[model samples]
Target: MKSPSIAKQLKRDRAFVLMFAPVLLYFILFKYVPMFGIVISFMDYNLFKGITGSEWVGFKYYAQFFENRDAFVIIKNTVLLGAYKLLFGFPAPIVLALLLNELRHAIFKRFVQTVSYLPHFLSNVVVASMLIMLLSPSTGWVNRIIEGLGFPAISFLQESEWFRSIYVLSEIWQQVGWGSILYLAAITTIDPQLYEAARMDGAGRWKQTLHVTLPGIAATVVIMFILQIGHALEIGFEKVFLLSNAATYDTSDVIATYVYRVGILQGGFSYATAIDLFMGVIGFLLVYATNQLSRRLGETSLW
Candidate 1:
């Protein structure tokens, strides 16, 4: 009992389905297939014994994770770091796009965009190595410059307080330009006539941007915000893993790093899986809530 419009829409969506077939296959193979393995989180996972042979101990792994001394510290660190990035990194690209949109010279804008975007293509290992070299107290160029400017050289990578700052700054450097690509695209689609009308009414550049440009991209912004909420807990592991040392463990030891240590290094499969499950569930719930909030607030939602 499909409606005519529904049937017609389905017919029109055939090309989209065809285009998405490979992506669907990838999800089925890698993503959904892994869900079947989540059962180990409830079992006493043994490397010697296969998943099928593992003994079930329902909730034991979960309890272990909750009660572990390191659990709270790791969770707190992860959440705090993630929250910091969300607060600062999330809006950075939007601001960049706005500023870039204001540029009258195409050549300068293109050069700036190119320079900004280039960092995103660099490997985490390279970025970390570069940071380490730059921030080295004695031999690094940054420290040399600081010392030359009549300041004592700072051990940036070693200090606990500096860890988060370095992490956040490097992340912003790596991703801001790439992130702005989407925002710039959104800005480009805004109606030219609206800006012209604003000008005719004697609106300044700031006023036009605030009224026309921002509102035009509000939906794009909202949708991206909701998606970012979904990944709030799942911070980038590569960058942190590469940059962090024992000295900065308090601030940098996030869920992913903990998982790597416990699961991969220590072979505590059940415990790691339990932690992963907890994070995944919480992250999903947050995304859902934010999506609902977005829908309620205005004209932008994933649904």
Candidate 2:
């Protein structure tokens, strides 16, 4: 039989199309449309002159950024923060999903999931305030415990050494449950007979999880990992900005906050745009490389 015409197919799937229309419009309006501003990175970007009227100065801002004294430090801080978050945060959801899968008590499992997921919905501002209150060297619970052990209270937010750790841990705590939702959904798609067969062969829970559950969700994990790698350099601005102070700038300053300071605050639009565009290109390259590597090593890839 001949395939339905385009119009007929659209009519048949009208409900699905209606559901997706808003998302498509959103990306066009917020994501893709604004990409045109990238050209400002190569221009002087006068506020009144605008894109067409601005003087073109190709590579000048990029060169200046690279030549700056603080460039290396800024880049290093961004990379290390991204790497640490990826290293710790990537596995957290997977571990949570596996543990949750083993739980037979529905009420307790849902309670744990609900508690873990609640932090993800909190605004960055609130989370930052909570962190400050919880880690205060003077009256914070964390420091209280430390003092209880006869050790001196440590100012976690003020210290440069603790910035990355604090950021990573907070991210994991906020996102682990929400992230695990995908893995849990993937686990449900696995055939039950596989688990039953494993049981028939005297395979324990751990063995079933290792051999069956993990492999079942391996594709989802790979896709998620690849997507995470794509955003390795694109850390969110609000939480880091709210959490960081001058004392912690050495470790906490990242590309997003740097762009905000330079582009929005200092009015070096071209210079800041150049830095952002450069990082975006690097992120794209990382995603491409990771996807290519995944394709070669396994059946899973973003493509």
Q: lDDT of all predictions, in order shown?
A: 0.90, 0.92
Which predicted model would earn the best lDDT? 2
Cα-lDDT of candidate 2: 0.92
lDDT tens digits, residue span 267-288, model 2: 9999999999999899889988
Compose the digit string of candidate 1's lDDT tens values, residues 1-303. 955697688798989988999999999999998998999999998988989899999999889888898899899989988888888999999999999988999999999999999999999999999999988998999999999999999999888889888888888999999999999999999889999999999999989998999999988888888778767888888989988889989888999998988999999999999999898889889888987887888767778
Q: Which 10 consecutive positions of candidate 1 have the poorest summed lDDT?
A: 2-11
Q: CA shift at 32, candidate 2, in angstroms? A: 5.5
Model 1 lDDT, full chain set: 0.90
The positional error of residue 81 in candidate 2, measured at the CA in angstroms, is: 1.6
Clashing pairs in 1: none
